[model samples]
Target: MPMAANEIEALIREGIPDAEVEITDLAGDGDHYAARVTAESFRGMPRVKQHQAVYAALGERMGGVLHALQLTTAAPAKE
Candidate 1:
């Protein structure tokens, strides 16, 4: 079974409490998704670690139900 966009978004928010998450069904197939996650905590975090965090949130689903994910993460603008 493939994961839902809301499910993915919720998982990301759960992992990063204050994150602003946007989940998109890139292929309309539930299997392929694109996620944009922005949070203050990610301010100085490395990109790889940020991606890892999102993956960790999805947990075992990464390679299983959740097949492909194109992820983008960033901190809120300094302003």
Candidate 2:
């Protein structure tokens, strides 16, 4: 089964409480998605590590039920 956008966002939020998450259905198919996650907590982390954090939130579903995802992460911009 494909994961829902809200479910992805919820999972990211669960892992990073301060995350600003935006999910897009890339292929108009539930199996493909692109997620943009911004959080202050991501500051100072390498891109790979930042992505790892989001993947960790999804547990074992990354290549299973979640299928494909193009993920982007960033620290929130300072005001």
Candidate 3:
């Protein structure tokens, strides 16, 4: 089964409590998605690390329930 957008958002939020996440289905199918996440936890982290963090949030779902994710991560914008 494919993961739901809310489920993906919840996972990211679990990992980064302050995350602002937007998930969109890239294809009509639920297996592919694009997620843009802004979180304080990403501050000073490298792009690869930021992506890794988001992936970790999904646990083992990366290659299973979630087939593909196009992820964009950013630190919270400075006020």
Candidate 4:
């Protein structure tokens, strides 16, 4: 019951509609992933807080369906 990349992306999008997400399969097993997400919602949030936001989007799946996620989150870059 590994989590798919699309599933992860969709969940993030559900939480932050304007999110720009790049998901990579770190292990090629669908269980380990790395995600780089940029969103306005992350503006002013601390790094840990930003990561928590993304984790919260996954709910209980964090330990079960989704094994591991390495995340890099930030507000969208200034033009």
Per-prediction CA RMSD (Å): 0.7, 0.7, 0.8, 0.8
Candidate 3: segments with Cα more than 4 A from true spot: none
The top-ranked prediction according to lDDT is: 2
Which portions of model 1 miss their true places by more than 4 Å? Answer: none
Residues 1-79 of candidate 2: C-alpha lDDT, one tens digit per residue: 7889999999999998999999999998899999999999999999999999999998898999989999999998898
| Candidate 1 structure quality by residue, lDDT tens digits, 1-79 | 8899999999889999999998889999999998999999898899999999889998999989999999999999988
The lDDT values for all models are 0.92, 0.94, 0.92, 0.91
lDDT (0-100) at residue 49 of candidate 1? 94
lDDT of 4 by residue, 1-79 (tens): 7889999999988977888999999999999999999999889999999899888887888888999988899998898
**Lowest lDDT 10-mer window, candidate 3?**
1-10
TM-score of candidate 4 on Cα atoms, chains taken together: 0.94
Count of backbone collisions within predicted model 1: 0
Task: Please provide, for model 3 over 1-79, each residue's C-alpha lDDT reduced to its tens digit, 9 standing for 90 to 100.
Answer: 8888999999999987889999999997999999999988889999999999998989999989899999999998898
- Once fitted onto the true fold, the runs of candidate 4 whose alpha carbons sit more than 4 angstroms away are none
